[model samples]
Target: MENLFFNHGKDKLLWETEDKILLAISGGVDSMVLLRLMEKLALKETIFLVVAHVNHKLRQESDEEEAYLRAYCKRKGIPFYSIQWQQATSFGMEEAARNFRYNFFQEVMEQTACNKLMTAHHGDDQAETLIMKLARGGSLNSHIGIQVRQPFSNGELIRPLLQFSKEDIRKWAAEQSLVFFEDQTNEDTHVQRNRIRKWVVPELKKENARLLAHAQQFSQQLEWAEALISEQMEKEFQTHVKKQAESWQIEGDWLMALPENQQYFFLSYFFKKSLSELQVGAKEEQLLQLLRLLKKEKAQWQVAFSNEWFFKKSYQQFSLEKNKQVTDEHHVLHYDEGVYLNDREWIGILKNVELDKVPAELEQIGWSTFRQDFPKDLAKEFFLRRRRDGERLHLTKNLTKKVSRYFIDNKVMNAKRATAWVLTDSKNNIYGLLPFTLSYLSIMEETDKIHYVLLYKYRE
Candidate 1:
């Protein structure tokens, strides 16, 4: 066992004498056995080792376990770092604890200048993970289970014990006379992993003695398949997808042109590569519904992707974007006092402006800039506000058009329509739609007097 472990470290991990490794120790049997093996390797190869422990403060023995590990590390003359998870969560405690654990491990790695983070995920854990993922249903990526090694933070996360099962670790620990804590929570079947570990895995192992090895082999095979599929998907993505700031845009026709299966694969690949932080799930139903919506006859449609994001189909263009949560803007305008319409837009009223000799800045204010003349008798105090529902604009002396209808006629995107401002009076009389159209009442003719000029400025 020792020879196999040493060879695995030197060959598979490619560990050198100068390489500093941060070990995530939980005081459990699996991690304790890992620490013992790493210590043996350090003695033989002179490799640097740092011990990091996270005290979840969930179990009653957590404090004791942390103190025991700290003392053990000190006795071995090894650097020890530990953190306590002070924030208690009511639900999803297991996942929350796992996140806190790895986060502390990363901080320790950074502080100690370690280039590798090691965890003790064994073959049994891998089998359980695969079973849980398969039963729960997810994309092929999820079924790949815990990886033996992957990039984490500034370095790599390595699970050297993945090739060994739990029984093997326990047996080796016994032979070495190592003292390790047994987490009682592992016996509680209330947790899905614990439940599967107690009943489902053992039954499967009975049918096939090499269940652990087979599970690991399946994971490696799936990883290879995913790589091949991803290579092709990336090429297709570059050809069909357009990235705009934080959002992603794709041609609807291009997506619908692909085979139905490829469409699902492409969408899955796009979400995983581009918007991974959003944690969008690859549910078959959700993807099928999106595909159906794309095939509909409607020119434009939108559906919520998540609470903070949405998928929009505008004409022939499909996009995934963050929901723009804009508060209704209503600012009272004063002469020469500029008010911000949005983050980059500024609007103000200028008095006594010559129509022929507009300010140089106003002259260069792009096409979205509104510089219309309004009769001084229009209102005593004019304000700028976002377009309200059921509002109408005076297009002619006897013609009126719904504000929503005007936006549709002009083909303005839903996002743009939300930010469009309306120039109005205290009595809610619409003066004009800034940067788009002027109300017939606000338009100045050669016969009508122009006293106030509404100036709009947009900063790039």
Candidate 2:
């Protein structure tokens, strides 16, 4: 551990900042080594340490680990924070425990005014994760392995030790004589990772002595592939993602034009953002199918990713949105109910109201309630659908401009224009396209109350 700290410990690399770091110490070998390294490096001067431990409360010895951590922190004169989670009785114990830990970490960080959090997930753990994900038929994103730097609530979560192997961590712990509690369940085959660690890994290692090394190589290749694909997808989004007068949109035509691999990565990026905001995962196939929902045929579709956000596939665009309880950066309002995007920017709503008897489903489309006082002539068409090729507006009945071209001329982002909902009638006539003007479109009849909702509920 002394040599490791002198040579390449996490303390020097990521802790140079004046951030109070909440170290997630499970009393496992890796975590103990992390605590010891911090001590050895004397990083506490620059980085305040909060030894945060969570008792999963699964095994009887779980609480014991918590006790040991508390005692160790007290002996070291370090402040310690702890949480006990009872929610693991649910089937998704790992996920549930993780969520609880993060929530607690955020709370503690805020209370301590901490700037970052650190975890000791070493390289071998990364390899195991890659193998596990592949064994479960992983996607490109899954193979990316846990990110080196992940976003936490207000600060960042740093995993500097991930570059090292489990053997490295063990050697460090042994050299430092670090005290840590062993969770016997780690050896249980009932857990998938344990089974892989025991039966699968050993057999593979026997068949090919460098299997771990090979897995490491695969992980690196996947990382590079992910980065290259992500770059291409970003360029595509740069070309396609746009903002119209109010609503945001993405060009389906442009997306479809990308190479198949690019399509998957771009769609994955969009859906993963939505999923992260909504707190959902592992729905690559489901989300890929959902991308079609962004075509011109549908004005809006909602998808649930747990409770953080609702994915909106509307107006030829896909986006992640938060619940009413969350703050809106654009509106800067609590935005609980429906909101007519202030300053004519956009309209986002959370209710299930139907406008003009448009056969509304729950939260699929925020139908605009046309006021009886509003002139029907003001609506080029009464039906609500995303803009399409056959769609056109009669500027003077003598000539027409493609809504797509009109949007471009209007300086609306191509991506946003593709997804922006345009009002139309059952006769397939253009009603009023949602404009990104500084104010309501002059076309919006003063007597009419346009109902628009930005947040869409997740589709079943």
Candidate 3:
């Protein structure tokens, strides 16, 4: 009994001594047990108990569930909150309901002056999720199971009831003679989770007789394993995430050399922990594919997870960053030998005219020393910057046409062509334009050369 409560009741420590709790009650067995436990434990405390419910309007019985939950909370002297969403006649009911629920939880927490929110996720729920992931082929993150004290990247959201098993909760509810409304939709097999709950666990249990216990213990062990790995990786990750003048980059060579499993673990971990502030999870196939292919020297791969949310692999570097929106900014640069722009992370060089003097010797050199090759005869240099105002450039060497017209002459995307910057002469005429257009022919020339160097920028 001591182990049961200590193991299961450990989550209560997260609650503030004098703070309020905004519990998400579904009027189901799981939430009912949780509510009753809170009532029994916090009955004498000076904490406020607020009930937050999402009326998804999924079934005819949902209204009754809501009413019952309201009445139960009222009887216990706890505050109650309920919200109803009129969903459209579309699919993805679970996802829509989840969205509604989470948004409503945020609203209720804000309105009630509570920052802590608790859910009714138990060990059985965790086990079911693991088995489902296994059936579909588990990845490195699938084994994370339910988070005992989950938080958003900014430490805003949290889950507390993840350590206890549903059986333990059910037994506790029985001991207290607690009653909660039954959700008829839970019995409907239309949902994948329901099917797993009805058939998968029972069948597995019948085969092993102790499979449930094993799974629970195994999941705890996996949590421990994940903790040890994460602790070690954090030390290494601190050294690897470096910053540059313009962007962030993690090394491909060092990242590729890690052990296979650790490679998968750290890749996903590093991206979620260090890169985009959005949530990330690994599909085993996708993780394996990236590890196998990210080694190619110059090959590129790109995928858009969502609008403006994209990841790309180019020139042996994996770039996870926002999409660049081009702008119409006028720029000028004087004819110069060598120039540097912190934003472009490049050193620009132009030497005296020599048709056969290609810039081969500048390849794969350090940023500090690359500009030493600049010829002193044409030493005049000027700096360039990005802007979004009206700007124009010449299309040809004759300086007779605007850069926009040149892009139009070549049928380039107007949105993309608008962002072209140019180098100018001392008299404010176009000498050459920076590369943004597809057919701009901006490659480094033998006598006229420019080098873009990727420095160890900070990780996103």
- TM-scores of the candidates in the order shown: 0.73, 0.58, 0.63
Q: What is candidate 2's lDDT per residue for 260-351, written digit by digit as tens?
A: 65666777776554345434683766666665554336555667655645556544445554433412122221222333333223232222
Candidate 3's error at 344, in angstroms? Answer: 5.9
Q: Rate the local accuracy (lDDT) of all candidates.
A: 0.83, 0.62, 0.60
lDDT of 1: 0.83
Q: Which candidate achieves the best TM-score against the true structure?
A: 1
**Best candidate, lDDT-wise?**
1
lDDT (Cα, 0-100) at 311 in candidate 3 = 54
For each candidate, how many residue pairs have backbone atoms clashing (under 3 Å)? 0, 28, 11
Q: Model 3 — TM-score against the truth?
A: 0.63
Per-candidate alpha-carbon RMSD to the true structure? 5.3, 13.3, 10.5
Candidate 1: residue pairs that collide: none
RMSD of 2: 13.3
Q: Worst 10-residue stretch by lDDT in candidate 3? A: 451-460
Kindly report which residue stretches of model 1 are placed more than 4 angstroms away from their true locations once superposed: 55-71, 83-90, 227-247, 272-285, 306-308, 322-460
